[model samples]
Target: MPTDTQILAAIDAAFGDSPRPEHFTHYRHCCECAEHDELLRHRDRETLQHADVGNAGWDPICFCSPEGIAYYFPALARFALAEPVPELDWYGWQMVFHLDYGGAENPFFQHCAPQQRQAVAGLLAHLLETRTGLLEMDADSALRAHGVWAG
Candidate 1:
């Protein structure tokens, strides 16, 4: 199995060094990724105290909220915001961050690692219940933007 170091190095080699892939993994089957996934989840809940952070983030634990989304917007939307998403599942949101941070065009969507996919799942697990109305999620990726961000 790939060590966490190797996996992270791969991500850095591929995605660069600003937002380190510390909390996420691009490799799915990696046991290390699965382990990290669980760890990040625990960290997420602990950090938020399982509450909706209207504009909260950036402590030892970083989570997505209405506030964080703006920070990540448009930079890596191509992969995350693609139309015809089959489901508003894990990968859907994972693509929102931890990808090649640029825009809809520059990113090589195909290059996303498995751990990155897992990251989306963790993000959604934390925010879905807390957020409301803006994300109209169907059974699948038929995600629709119903309204603007609600305060």
Candidate 2:
């Protein structure tokens, strides 16, 4: 498991040349999001295992995948803060219930207007873009730093 400091360092190194205010801001947000996703994934995975062993009453929790850490977490933070209402595709709807309402019930789903949903969708999109951009940036930086840019 990478420590937060290490992750941040990697992010910094990845973006050192092109570091913008947005990069730093998104990096911080991504770290927090990753932590949240990790907590959720751990809890969910444990609950699933327990259920498989006949513990039906086990509390379900979320578990973060490396991909989740790299992607979803930051996206969620942006979405929640911005409170955008986006069109619900199948996956998006699932995310709302599976992720957004996994352990705790969110009143936002019930009370949010159409505009709110749109905002949420926009936030999700932003998160996805940030995650993709970070990964690409990191990969490019790693190649250059290691003198493997040609490969």
* Clash count for each candidate, listed in order shown: 12, 20
Candidate 2 lDDT, tens digit per residue, 1-151?
3433443344333323321111211223466545443444443211322121111122111333323322333333322223223432222222333334422233333333344334344433433443444334243332222221111
Give the lDDT of residue 16 in candidate 1: 44
lDDT of 1 by residue, 1-151 (tens): 3433343343334334234233343326566545534544444311432122111232211333222232232223322222333333333334323222332232322233444433333333323432323234431221211110110
TM-score, every prediction: 0.24, 0.23
> Quick one: RMSD of model 1?
15.6
Judged by lDDT against the true structure, how good is candidate 2?
A: 0.31
